[model samples]
Target: MTHRGAEPPDGTGFLAVRCDVTDSRQVDRAFEEAEAAHGPVTVLIANAGVTHDRLLPLMREEDFTSVVDTNLTGAFRVARRAARGMLRVGHGRIVLVSSTAALHGAAGQSNYAAAKAGLVGLARSLTREFGPRDITCNVVAPGLTDTDMARALTPEQQSELLRRTPAGRAAHPDEVAEAVAFLAGAGYVRGAVIPVDGGAGLGH
Candidate 1:
């Protein structure tokens, strides 16, 4: 589900419904609408995320909770909802879009890091729970992607990250999407954490 109305440029076989992942009702309704339009959902990508950057010492309780609620708990809501249809069909793919911060913690991002880290646990646990049913769960951890979120980072932050990255540049959004697409089709690659971070998360 997206937060804004979206339509395919080609305008065929696509419906974009605005739904908030943090709300269970919205999550259910979104799935209902999708299923109504195109039948039961066989693939789910839990990609909703938000950041509230602050050092642990300076972070407010809400900062931590809100990030976790949206990034981690929101994933849970959608994954759980999608599992129902997958269970009936006995086949599915769930890909969670995590971050390199989840593997190598970023300074001033304790909340975002923790929330993303939780996704690994959730995906692995779901892998075990759903494997017997022919369902797979995986995570894609991307770093410094060329997206609005990455652009929002200060130039200094971007420079520091690029300096650390062996490839010396940010990833294209399509690079991350490629990994997600691979996971969706690879039935044997369950509970894996694929990093599309241009080696920025190497050795972590």
Candidate 2:
């Protein structure tokens, strides 16, 4: 697949790089390389993630730390770098990939939920600090998505999730990606968290 830049279907101005979000060396190198290829990172999508699920009392230290390192600290690394560029240029987009668990609280996902929830605050804080510079920071909270990650679940679990979801099915990853793309494109929008959860957790 493509990794460096977007073609006609995607756009003229884009550079896509695969990076380990948890690693500072990789993040620095990737951003440096991407900036060289496509100018500064005007739009940042911190979507790198992983799951280490287990009940809190039964969970190991590594499990909790790993998820926190990747989901929370990882996004922070990328966003911090991107924000620096955005603040300097006086314009940018920072759309974080959060989760419905961030709000609803997953039974065996304390680490994941806490990490994702932190992103909302992080995005909002940036919005206040950088809004005058035309930088918009937002979050997209996706529900059960029909990705390899969800497909790995038992068939019964998948079916039950579909039953609970108002749309009666899992969402395509592109569906969530669309929300992120929207926030990226809309210059005036900032500090917003859009839930792409098919009405699964329309909280109070």
Candidate 3:
């Protein structure tokens, strides 16, 4: 696990530590450091995910399994660790960052879609388990966004996607972040899948 940023000044109230979510040891250590610096963790954003897109037939077993392990199981790892402190504190927020692909599906992204779809179940389950403790678990699913990942699409692919999107464009990363922020403050919002897509996956 490696991070490339310096810590904030003493009173800036922020810390970004290197954490490999797929590795439980690293996850635990990251939280330990956070708890020591701050107080008990009251909010958790399980947003670590990766994608390895390949047609189902040509996709290697490792590709499929690794995507699931990191995207789905990794969210589980971080949330589980955070929940311990949240439960003791008796209040918390857990927002899982998912994708529109999980709702509408995408060709050559079976593994990614599957892993993201799993987050919905994970969030809902956690809500049921932790609601009594005042811990809300929810999912924020974003569609194609104007990020480096979107910039990699071929011209034709990009054009087709934009044409299909109801908003006639990809989303801005800040739009998705805004949705996550809303959920963070919404203590009553639990087990919900909030779509940050520009109506791309509207029906679902």
> lDDT: which candidate is best?
1
Q: Per-residue lDDT tens digits of candidate 1, residues 1-204?
A: 455344435545457776888899999999999999878889999998889998889999999999999999999999999999999899899999999999999999999999999999999999998757789999999999999899889999999999999999999999999999999999999899999999997777
All models: lDDT? 0.91, 0.83, 0.86
Q: Write the per-residue lDDT of candidate 2 for residues 1-204, one digit (tens) a residue.
A: 113222324564545565777788878888888888877789888887778879989999999889989888988999898877777788899888899889888778898999999999998998888847788889999989988778876797678767878998899999998898898899887898899989997553
Roughly what TM-score does model 3 have, to 2 decimal places? 0.92
Q: Over the full model, what C-alpha lDDT does candidate 2 score relative to the true structure?
A: 0.83
Count residue pairs with overlapping backbones in model 3.
0
TM-score of 1: 0.95
Better of 2 and 3 by lDDT: 3
- lDDT, candidate 3, 12-94, per-residue tens: 44676778888999888888888888877788888777788889889999999999998899999989998999989898999
Show where candidate 2 strays beyond 4 Å: 1-16
Which stretches in model 3 have alpha-carbon errors above 4 Å? Answer: 1-13
Residue 163, candidate 2: C-alpha displacement in angstroms: 2.5
Full-model lDDT, candidate 1:
0.91
Q: Model 2, residue 136: what's the lDDT? A: 87
TM-score on alpha carbons, each prediction: 0.95, 0.89, 0.92
Candidate 2's clash total is 0
Model 1 ranges with Cα > 4 A deviation? 5-13
lDDT of 3: 0.86
